[model samples]
Target: MDDEARRDHRTVGDVDLTTWRTRAGRASASAWVRLGDRFGALPLLLVTLLIGIAIAAVCTWVASEVYDAVREADDVAVLDRPVLDFAMSLRTPGLDTVVTWWTNVAGTVGMPIVAVGFLVGFTIQRRAWTPLVLLVAASAGSLLMTVAGKDLIGRARPPLADAVPPYERSPSFPSGHTLNATVIVGTIVYLLLLRQSRRATRVWTVVLGSVFVVSVGLSRVFLGHHWLTDVLAAWALGLAWLALVITAHRLYLTALRRDGASDIHRPS
Candidate 1:
């Protein structure tokens, strides 16, 4: 065996059925095709590992830049007040109640239920723990980011007076609601797509997930529970972490294909 082949053999096992499903799914994506074509079997995992690292670095850089601006209250941070004020102005007591209830349903409590339900349902359907593991990783990483951003920046939410009832006290530079929704919902859709081959289904899945994540972010702002910049940073940070997880899955598949896993092309 070549040095690279020997190295890959040591790094990961031959392809398993469930993970092979991910590889099968990616083969249909043009971007994934371009990415995979560049790698020979031996170096695929190594290259994927490098790609995941690059994604992490870019995400951290983007998040940090947003943080620095917010910390200094310049750049995009300058719009925080006006945007928030406009959101506040549009609210009436009825609207505040509606948005607040919806945010609650979509944010902290609701997201966990949806994630756990998805993990359980898919684990049953696929008879595989891969989806469960990914969900845990996505949820845990997002929660860690939320806590770290809150602690590191110690940025406060809008005054309780401006916010709807049942106010939050956490530091709010990056909205946990927005961050968690983006990571969890985004991960769910990606996994769902691995098993979905229909063009219309995939398109709708992407669209729905995007709307849900965006709604979560906007809800935080409308409720005056967070600033506009907080949600933007949350999305950028969430996307970075999601990239890391998905690429790690891709790396797993790359290892499998090296051992002769079949292409298993997407149906037309």
Candidate 2:
């Protein structure tokens, strides 16, 4: 759409490219609002971000520290029984095949599938830029955080010392599968809820999200790539990340309201 036509069509709740720019511009302006109306949101968002980082950092640090301590302790032998028992409980050939297939689906194709869906939203609404930016940011942010966490913790993988030809050589404090699944699925759900408020949409989003999160976490265990603790930590970290981002997005919306931009992003 041409600039003038786009601008003319933009409304307060719109989800098109122009509305996205309007929303972001409103957000930027709201960030710098001189009046006291927005004083609360900015600091609160910053604090939320800081708190998330702190939690992730502390958990990661503690995990690494504990791994070393346990490795050297005589009680290390005590852990083997429970770990083995847990692994045994998950040992079913049928489940393994299913998880293996789903794992491949989630990792190789799920993300791109989500991205393409987002692109459809962008195309239909002529808001190509907004979803594009949001998805790209989520993807980059998820990857960077996972890699950094892996490097920082430097925890060893599940000990398959002799059987594998080549194995993942990174820390396993938080499973990358857990991270990617949470972020990608979380982003899709969040965006869908943002754009559509129907009861069925909300219910389906919740159901789909719950299933994806649980299945992905379970797949990590079935694949023998992560300890239960690692998947748990990843879930915690992912939720914390999503909460911070949502908080920021809402704060930006509030800022826009305070900035006298009422007609900026209405859905057509």
Candidate 3:
């Protein structure tokens, strides 16, 4: 009935907490050693940091350009109303109902549930933490950007008169639904690809994931819940964050080499 006894009770991958911790500790130590031995920690870190900064800057610039275009009603903003109008023209009561249902999968309440489902399923299946760690990093950054962009830009949604009901109150420069869908779904797809072997299956998985992400973005414009520019910015921002997450994870894998983290992360 002490700390040692408590570790005996807890478990992961059929190993008790104590054993799991020891294995994880060893894997981590070995990974760092491999990293330092191969490239030296400082140099690798500097290289990764520079790449990350470049990716972030590009994404930020793209989003900001879209935001300005929308604000000034020129450039890409020129297409905003016409696209919305085309979407509106196609809107039937039946179509509206279906699109609304589809869009909600990426909405505030629904997206969290979707993320939790993936996290829980991955943990239970693999008994590993790598996917959750990477996915959470990707999502947390995207969520922060969504909130920050909304607040800073304070962009308005398309006129309520044009939108479907159950209206959202948040500022709408970057569509939260589109951004979350891009990052969360994208990361899931990427993690799955890491362990996937069948070429046919991998192709299908990527195709379906890409289609779903695009559909979610389109649904926002169709529902008049977000402008075309909002979805565009979200895509740019989400891709930016997702790229950073994947690059960082790849760097970790490079450091870990094939011995410890590679197999640990790719747990079958």
TM-score of each: 0.74, 0.66, 0.75
Off by over 4 Å in 1: 1-66, 258-268
| Candidate with the greatest lDDT versus the true structure | 3
Per-residue lDDT tens digits of candidate 1, residues 145-264? 777777667887898888887889988878899988998999899878776657788789999999989988998999889989889888988898887777666555443343233343
Q: Positional deviation of 151 in candidate 3, in angstroms?
A: 1.5
Per-residue accuracy of model 2 over 1-268 as CA lDDT, tens digit each: 2342232222223343223345665554445333325354335445444554555556556655675676577454465336645765766678666677686656646767866776686556754344554455555556656776788766666776311222455677678878778876787777666656466877788798879888888776656677766776678767766665654444434433432444334423
The CA root-mean-square deviation of candidate 3, after full C-alpha superposition on the true structure, stands at 9.4
Query: Per-residue error at 14 for model 1, in Å?
Result: 23
lDDT for each of the candidates?
0.71, 0.59, 0.72
Report clashes for each candidate as comma-separated counts. Answer: 0, 11, 0
Candidate 3, residue 49: the lDDT equals 46
Worst 10 residues of 1 by lDDT: 4-13
Q: Which is the winner by lDDT between candidate 1 and candidate 3?
A: 3
Residue 149 displacement in candidate 1 (angstroms): 0.9
